[model samples]
Target chain A: MSYKDKKVITIGVVRDLTGLSERQIRYYEERKLIFPERTPGGSRKYSFADVELLVEIANKIEDGVQTHEIRKEMLRAQKKQNQEDVRRKMIQGQLNAQFGLRKGPTS
Target chain B: MSYKDKKVITIGVVRDLTGLSERQIRYYEERKLIFPERTPGGSRKYSFADVELLVEIANKIEDGVQTHEIRKEMLRAQKKQNQEDVRRKMIQGQLNAQFGLRKGPTS
Candidate 1:
């Protein structure tokens, strides 16, 4: 999921879900590793992808990867995901053409 | 220069050059905006480009941009730089063909 969805979620909840401490979560925010939304009151809120990223970052740190390396890895991961999406879309288009359906696949 | 080129300078030199504190420099390193190399003794060394990037990062931060946003901006900047390089090469190829120099422009 993208960062736009999942409004009304707070950092405390994210900490609980990701098992990352509040400080580390804030640290990640400060590092720009994750861009969580801040409320009118300045409380941090995380999206689903943000939580996933924090967990991923935690695992990467445990694997001896630094934050900048993790950022690079994430960029690579996002590029791969985009390529996969394009590949899937092409396959779906081919399938639709074979079936003679103007509408796209429901799935 | 890329992150691999410079390999003997220390964080102190970067601090002096950028006017960024040692902790903040280390913090940025931890955040991974710039990747400097380390010596065999584990000292951080800044490349010319790395130093430029640190100065850029300082400007971005002062302008109230977060690290993740800055990261995205940097990716865009790199992509733009790559496009400019490609455009330059294409022009150079055209010039070489017009000059009957398959070896390319002397300058």
Candidate 2:
């Protein structure tokens, strides 16, 4: 796991970082907008990435965007990104094949 | 917009391309999973990108993933990807500054 993926930050820290209330954070979690890991004692532990996502979610909500619409837009953007990645990799693979490289393609 | 974003394909063509029933495609639209443009005569039109997205949505549904969960996962993945892109651009900017480049960093 990367440093941002480590779930070591508490909800209070996230609340301070994102300027969102505790109840609001919990509500986002209930709506499946954010997923924080659960501690052994059942406390919530959020990652750095989750904090950034919460800030983004809050910004969209403040701009009058619904949570569901935000989710859908994200999905569509991700689908486009995945397609781009696949296309890039395919081109890289063909380039490598043409250059007689076994595996790695030169950056 | 790119070629993939042009909403020129009809639902029937998308059905032929994706093997999805018309009703199923319309249902996904109703659920706000896909957004197709409309013609002056009120015909639904989809883009090449939308067709690809529909196929991806179908695969996730067939794999027993709930639509909401799939959307949430996509949002999180997209958030991570945006962060990566920002980091990459920042590094590129720093490299350009070091090289005294005024604009357009070389790829």
Scored by lDDT, the top model is 2
Poorest lDDT segment (10 consecutive residues) of candidate 2 chain B: B1-10
Candidate 2 chain A, which ten residues in sequence have the lowest lDDT sum?
A1-10
Per-residue lDDT of B15-56 in model 1, one digit per residue for the tens? 655788999888888886878766545667565466678888
- Candidate 1: C-alpha RMSD to true structure equals 21.3
- Model 1 C-alpha lDDT per residue in residues A1-107, reported as the tens digit of each score: 33234433456556656888999999877776888766555767555567677898999899998888888877898899999999999998888789855666757
Estimated TM-score for each candidate: 0.42, 0.44
Against the true two-chain complex, what DockQ does each candidate achieve? Answer: 0.01, 0.01
Model 1 segments beyond 4 Å from truth?
Answer: A1-107, B1-8, B102-107
Positional deviation of residue B104's Cα in model 1 after best superposition, in angstroms:
11
Question: Which DockQ value does candidate 2 get?
Answer: 0.01
Local distance difference test values of all predictions, in order = 0.73, 0.80
Name the top TM-score candidate.
2
